[model samples]
Target: MIETDKNQILLNMMTDYAKNNPDTIFCYTNAAILYETPRWEELPLEIHTVQSNKKIKNRTAITHIRPYFKKSKYKGFNVITLVDLLLELAVNDTEISAISSISHHLYKNEISVETILNYCQSQKQKSGVAKLRHLVSFASRLDESPFETKVRLKLYVAGVIIPVQQHQVICQNKKKYRVDFLFEFKGRKIILEADGLIKYSSNVNERANERQRESDLIREGYEIMRVMNHDFENGRFAQILENYGIPKRRYYGKKIVKKHY
Candidate 1:
């Protein structure tokens, strides 16, 4: 029953915030009051003053002073921009300059606008860019995209020097296209594209464009290796290893999980 209450609280926060600000994105952290009990809700209103541990913070008054409270059917939290949240929080009494300053400060620390929005809607009072940075670090570890994360992890684990992502590729025609990952050795370029086949297919016009792009890339002598979601997931690492000519032990055929700290 206690767990159910927390879920209700979180749901309320998320639904209220979303309806009040339809343009704003809602994330779990935005409705994080449900993570702890009412007794632990009061953890110094200011984010800087708030303790890192959940069991230590007291955040009861958070529900009372929620910035958005028109309705009470919060389905879940979402991702939104900092600028939007600031506007929503302030409502008609918008503080433009102050919010811009805060947004600028957060962006400087590599905190995206989405991170700032989540922090603002959270229980912590006086939340700022600094605390937003901390939240971003915590959230990255909890990213939902498992396949992309694991591929990067597998490359790192096998001691392979993976190239930087979104690197630009210049073709013979002087046109450039950025790729997911690029590894340049001597004159040969090994391109690895992490293909998320959600909105793409071979029968569509987009596929035609993709074919042209690949043709142009191949014409430029790029040794491309398109790694799809299935490759890492369906136990096909051996095929990749052989294609890349990276000699592997018999253990390479087995599933490899990254044991990150």
Candidate 2:
């Protein structure tokens, strides 16, 4: 078989994969993440394409030639380029044309902003979507984590702009504890700690660790709010914020669709 024929065989595989897992976020930088993205796995899928490193107009295009394939604008309306499809999968705003252009690399298939949005809405309704919604809820409370990526998701929903993570703090003895979230408002240091100590062995050890951490923080004259895993999971995060003296903001009491087993 010729190389062209081999390439055709591969593209067909990718098309089949996409049809089955339409919501997976595909990107050049994160091939593994894309492949393992929810609902893509456990369904048995594969991607078929020609492997080439041709730089067209100073941009590297993953080139392929398949007769039956999805077409898009970025690939000149015949068949969608990998980049074009990636951009379509990454679509963000339906109302703003300017923002949609960011994903224009996948726009070649002539995928309209509306179509991208409809696909997104449908993707959000898939079986695991509820679990993902819970995950998004979990992620919103912090900006960064060695704990979990929950922080970024939490802030996004709460409309709380996240402070830089791992900001160092020195206690009176000069010992340091890197804080999870910190915000400076009205010259006060609002320190938020995602209490992930339960994963540590022994309830005794966990309590001791938290006590030491809190003592060290308090000694530094910083008011700290420690949030348990359950608070975020149960929609009690806003109350946790209030207990930390966040002054009852609007998003503090927002209700989320939480799934309970």
Could you estimate the TM-score for every candidate?
A: 0.44, 0.39
Off by over 4 Å in 1: 1-147, 199-203, 246-261
Collision count of model 2: 25
**Distance from true position, residue 131, model 1, in Å?**
16
The candidate maximizing TM-score is 1
- Location of the lowest summed lDDT over 10 successive residues in candidate 1: 44-53
- Taking every candidate in turn, the Cα RMSD to the unseen true structure, in Å, is 14.4, 14.2
Q: Estimate, for each residue in 1-261, the C-alpha lDDT of model 1 and write its tens digit.
A: 465565465456545544544443222122223334332234322011011122222322122223233333223433234343333333211122223223333433434656555665563555343333332332222222323444554565565554666678789899888776777765667887767444375578898888888999999888788776567666586568567864333343322221221
Q: What residue runs in model 2 are displaced by over 4 Å at the alpha carbon?
A: 1-147, 203-207, 247-261
Residue-by-residue lDDT tens digits, candidate 2, 1-261: 555454354445445554554433333222323333222122222231221122224322232223334533222213454333433322321211212222221223423434444444566644443333332222222232223344434554566644556578888787878887777666678787766544456788887987898888877777887666577776688666656655423454433333350
**lDDT per prediction?**
0.45, 0.44
